[model samples]
Target: MDENYSLAVPFYDLWHEDGHVPLIRELLPPLLKGVERSVIEIGAGTGLVTRVIAQETPAEIYAVEPALGMRSVLVNRLAEDPELLRRVTVLPCGALDVEVDEPVEAIVMISVLQSFPAEQRAELWRVLARQLEPGGRLVFNWRERAVPVPGDLEVMGSYEVGRHTYEVAGQVLEVAGESVTSRFVYRIRQRGVVVSEDEAVVTNHWPAEERLVSELEAAGFSRDAAPEGMEVWRLP
Candidate 1:
């Protein structure tokens, strides 16, 4: 888990429930259509995407989330429904450390690729391959990203909750090779007055599409057709 999210947990769902989640809701069902036995979800933050997976398939879910704060919210969300509580098994560990009783049919990773840096992705792929059945599928979202130019603070998203406004602002601090460092500020306001704020500096890696394809191919995965902005690779 990225330590950065530990500070942003309170505002995560508020910002993301409307951000890219709707796209995940739209794209994931088709990707997960035939996974009937089991699925592993890496970085299951706040159960936003987790709920999408649960609703789309009857497969038992091994939801691996490492951050305590995020996991708490995920557990709380699952507790709301008896079926979710029964079917979704939360794994309290990082992606590389995740373990399941057996190889699963598929693994879904949403907005989580950046968390694993270029050097670690090989091992990440290896870990994923080890836990997937032969011919199993790996589904994740990926799009070519333009190199970032250092930028000043800009408001990313804002939402109104009760009388308070929760706002997220970010600034690009540095760009080196495949890594970008940025600072995110989470703010709360009431009656236009700032009430509280927290900040986190997060670094994310962005590998070229060619590099990703090469890495996955080297790891024994072959490309499969997928919707735009999503990639599906199958182990053979």
Candidate 2:
């Protein structure tokens, strides 16, 4: 998994260059109006959002990313701005394992929550509940699954055949004749050690607006609308 992520880091970094930074910049000010002291970003991939936070907010920023490949890019990008670099601390850790000596006023998750598995999503929220100061904000964004793609009959038949062969062989075998389906799998890690696997199937969950809201409530978060693609929660 680490190798796969490392290989994709460069592409991911490049993909964010096309106007994403400005988009985040425009959306952040309202949510961050009175926030001060310290702000921490979880899953700070390539520092796209980190750059904006450093520029627009006066608080000390801590960017936490578990992937070394992503962290390296962040370190390099912040190298030139000593003023920004002075207020920033880059941690090679994930949300679950990050320990800040001082309590933070706000925690930003950006597009990171979907990366946690269903079983751990609640626990992740519980961890956040502990880390954040009372009344502090927890902001995140999730890709909404709008419409469902019907199951392909042909693929289902092929999958059945593959299952039969695996049962007969008593060992896992890659079925060559089966149609391959690719989906994003979110995993959780602590300091480079994988703590959980296959946490969420990005495409299969939250297929509607109601489901998205319900999931947030179930995870102990009370959500309010944000500019179109984002959601903001005030921690209780």
Candidate 3:
């Protein structure tokens, strides 16, 4: 995978330590209350949200993450809690590809939707729709945008991840005699595990909230906006 993403595991842990866990813990319960008994978390990333869900709800939990590195961390983190471990199944696969033996009461995407390309996001929604039992719920969050539309949907909830401010000092001169300076902005991962510097390609698609509503409607869901940082779509 991408080295940058691979290196991100450590950074992701650090990011969560800074404050991501509390934010996720705060927003998760309301969504959890709407579901019945089972919950599947797509892109579970080291179980930050999973831990919260397990603690707050009585539902069974299944966490899916495609990255080996992140999965390892998740497994280790849940190792001590035999009951939670028994109730949870950590799979190494993306949400669009996983097969569940039984229908689920709810499917959560959390910070995962932004990581998908447009097509993947659509496919993921479709897959989740199929997995839902009648009246099942899908809950997820995205970065908020100042403009009605943003270049990257990932930037919408960007503040949750925290911002990086930095300065540049020296410049490099090319053979042509022009001096250039480079500046970069970084985002901190608030909760969950992230594989950075890996070969993985992380893309964000922020189709407007209306677009998401329309898509859910097309997929046979009635959508509602939740104040805790996500949109809730319930199967009709």
lDDT of 2 at 177: 20
Q: Locate the minimum summed-lDDT window of 10 residues in model 2.
A: 165-174
- Model 2, residue 17: distance off in Å is 2.3
lDDT assessment of candidate 3:
0.66
lDDT-superior candidate, 1 or 3? 1
lDDT of 3 by residue, 1-236 (tens): 32434445644555555555677778878778855478899988878888888887778888998887788788988897897888898978878787788889988877777566555656777788888888788888865543332122132122233433211111122211111122122333324433221222233455566666677787788976687467788887
Tell how far residue 53 is off in model 1, in angstroms.
Answer: 0.9
The candidate, 1 or 2, that scores higher on TM-score is: 1
Which candidate do you rate higher for TM-score, 2 or 3? 3
Error of 3 at 198 (Å): 9.4
Which candidate comes out best when scored by lDDT? Answer: 1
lDDT of 3 at 219: 76
lDDT of 2 by residue, 1-236 (tens): 34545654644543445435566778877878787788999988888898877766799998988988888888888897888789889988878887888778888887666556556666777777677787778887655543433332221111112213111001111221211123333333455454444311122123245655665677666876678766787665
Give the winner by lDDT: 1 or 2: 1
Q: Candidate 2: list runs displaced more than 4 Å.
A: 147-220
TM-score of 1: 0.98
- Evaluate model 2: give its lDDT: 0.64
* lDDT by residue for model 1 (31-78), tens: 998889999999999999989998999999999999999999999999
Best candidate according to TM-score: 1
